[model samples]
Target: MRRLFRLLTIYAVFARYRLDELLPDHAASGIVKFFIRLHPAAWTASTQVHPWGRLRLALEQLGPVFIKFGQLLSTRHDLLPEEAIGDLANLQDNVPPFGEQAAFDIIEAELKGTTEALFGHLERTPLASASVAQVHAGSLKDGREIVVKVIRPGIETLVQRDLALLLTGARWLQKIVPETKRFHPVQVVTDYRHILLGELDLGQEAANGAQFRRNFADSPVLYVPEVHWNLSTNKVLTMERVYGVPVSDTQSMLAAGVSLEHLSELGVEIFFTQVFRDNFFHADMHPGNVMVSLKDPQNPQYLSLDCAIVGSLSKQERFLLARQLMALLDKDYEQIAILMVEAGWVPQSTRIHEFQNALRTVLEPVLERPLNEIEFGPILIRLFQTARRFEMQALPQFMLLEKTLIHVEGLGRQLYPELDIWEIGRPLLEQWLRDQIGPGAIMQTIKRNGPALIEQIPHIPKLAWDALQEMRKLSENQQKLLQQVEQGHLKQLRRDRIITLLGLIGLGAGLSWGFNPHWSLSWSEIPLGAWVISALGASLILTRLRSNPDD
Candidate 1:
């Protein structure tokens, strides 16, 4: 009942935001019309008017979950309407801290020691705080500086409960509402749960940081702080302290002697290198999380922090993304559209001609401009909007990729206003394309799999026997579920059967009265007929509601 109440509260809030107005227009009118008739209110047109502001406001009202969702959604530049994407991007992670003492208590308890023992000194003041966690500064025993990160207390329970509630609601929508199948609400929730789960583990983040550090150890372009593994826990993270001018502070960067144009071009090269060469890029390198190293001003290096979120593309996804980017650089719109469906990024049923036409309409206007002026932002939004028409399910990983890319692009332009991203992106992507589609790739794949394939050949018989056993078990489980559902149906039918029979009898009597109305038509016919009709309608609706969809 509490869960149900919570759900209704969510709906009530959504109603106020005018999200309900976004529901498809007059869809399934006959039976659906009566069901939704109680709620005559419509989705707000305000979402379109100053969409960005409206989006931020809606996310605020929805709380942390929505803020996080907005953050993720902002990354899918290729999958959202321009206004919607812009609005989501504008959402600030700014939120009030819980309390200084609450943070200290968590840190001390997590380390299982006093502040003095863990560090020479610890600062109570937080450098930054967000909806999920807070960060503080401290000095180690040897006077080496570090930062202490502590998860807000009681956060896990609240997050878990909210996630559970979300899952339950998603399941209900998928099962009870046939119309939602296309939208795949349950799958969306599943992806959401996995993302939340990833965010919950600071250990994973610490490892991500360490891996990033390892990958860039020999590079001069970037520096990642080492993870103090001993000091780090699942809820608490300790790492080497880093300092530099914030990436967003352009004036400071310029004053520090960094050549803006060179710095920006370098940033572009670093982004491509990370995605293609390293295959591991910091997916959350927002301006807030990045800084510019001022030691070598003219040849600047990027100071990166906050490795809590990272993204990696599958070999196939990376290849397709590379191919699509290359195609855009080559002015091959049809190739880009073809890769969309070929990569399973869009539904196969989408017509190539229609998809290509839609993309061309979006891209041509932008492409007519010089490469130096073209921004990836508008291009990404158009791509997503067009793909969505073809029923693409935006992957969570893709969102992170786009977010990082946007951050890189914005940072680059600030350093060098005239930098042509296409010039930087094209050659790198083309080389990657050659590497991926080359004969060497085929030989490598075969060589890597050859040994495994040979070993598996010897176990084929045993593997087949094991598979048969699993199939038998699965078949039995299905039978048992079927039986259980049948019993439940029988129980329900027993209860409704009496009501249905009484309803029929009442209906017959009402019909008889109407016929006898030939002798004397009276007001009794109206009441009798109404009751009979109500009862029959109620029975039918209940039966439809009660029956299991699978059954």
Candidate 2:
């Protein structure tokens, strides 16, 4: 019943927004339009707002899952129009906080204690509230300042319910509209489900924070706060409180003498280092989750928070990504197309020349712009879009990476409009590529695997001997099989020759009986014995000639 109500609410919102009008002109759209017209609200739906604005508003009204979907869609420049992307980018998780008593109750329930007993002092007011959780300022008994995050009451059930509806809609869309398969609506919803569920688990977020903190332990450009595991649970997380100017507050940063240029460049460097060197990145790098430390004004450092969604690449993906970046920097469209096909991003049968031309058409103009004017994130989106035309498969990891890049690049460009991401990223990628394939890399590979290789040396002779014995046995068996086949062939030949000779004799007897002068052409004039002999001879000759020697 609850699910049915939710579904109805979604439809109501859809009708209220006149979302059917947003559908492209296709057979599926006609079916959708027919149904939408049946809803009374669709006739009176407001048309004052633009379609994109209505879309954003409708998603916000549909609740957190849809809002999160809008947030994700905002980064998909390849899939959505610029206006829609802009509108969706404005979608925020600014949900009203649950009551303070409820928050305290959840903390107590998850931690197995009273809130008062657990903390030095827990604030009744929330420091911040988002779709999944709310934060409250507090401290430990030892007076160490901290912030407590409590999962919203019953958000898991709500998330699951909404995700189910989204998945259903995605499947229906795919089934009804064949062209929607390229958009991978089902996969998008499925990936979103995992991301949303992961965010609900504070323990996972805590572990992510710890790993990120460890990755940048000695770094001057980035800082990650320590997780207080003793007080952390799957539904409750406590971490050391951090205070700094929000990265988005350019006025405050500038007042503190922070060099926006240096800060923006550092952001790019940190992004590349995390992706190439650590192989782990903070996927959610929105401004609300980032801050700037004022202690070092000239050399700004980034304070990262909310490590719920992190991304990493496999070794091969990392290598290919690096090569692709290098190819992009060198304006080698053919190499870029080749690498994409080799990486299995596109089908093996994809025409390289056509793909190259498509890539050039999209990228050449963007690359021709000044370094400061180029944006890697949008370039990647365009590249993926071109690849999609050639039937590129969905890559979840790459999607996360692309989203992160969008966040990082957007943040950088906001800080300094003249930020040259190409200038900052080119050297990092070049160095990483060299490290992977240079002479030193070969030595390192040998050094890492030498012991394992040496351990298997003593059994080499035994393995080789066993392989040779197996091959010899196979050869002998094959020779015996060939001999049997040859013998069968010889027997068949002899039998066929005997049958041929018998057939010839029978045929000769039939001819002599039919041409004899004593017998007239009429059947009545021939003797019964002669007739029987002639028939028997003809039957024998026909049977012998028709027989198959092999059978």
Worst 10 residues of 2 by lDDT: 542-551
- What lDDT score is found at residue 497 in candidate 1? 67
> Could you tell me the lDDT of residue 473 within candidate 2?
100
TM-score of each: 0.74, 0.88
Global lDDT of each candidate:
0.77, 0.88
Model 2 agreement with the true structure over 1-551: per-residue lDDT tens digits: 99998878888888889988799999878987888777998988888999899999999998888999899778775577678878998996798999999999889988899978889998999999998999999889999999999999999999999999889999999998888887788988888889889999999999999999999998899999889997999999999998899989999998999999999999999999999999999888899999999987987889999999998999899998888888998899999999989988788999999999999999999999887888887788788778878888747788788888888898998999899987889888888888999999999999999999999899999999999999999999999999999999899768877766665665566567766876567766555666666666666556656776344
Q: Look at candidate 2 and tell me the lDDT of residue 234.
A: 96
Residue pairs of candidate 1 with colliding backbone atoms: 21-43, 52-87, 77-380, 78-384, 79-384, 260-415
Weakest 10 consecutive residues of candidate 1 by summed lDDT: 36-45
Residue range 376-413, candidate 1, lDDT tens digits? 86687777877777777767777677777878888888
> For candidate 2, what is the TM-score?
0.88
Candidate no. 1 TM-score: 0.74
lDDT of predicted model 1? 0.77
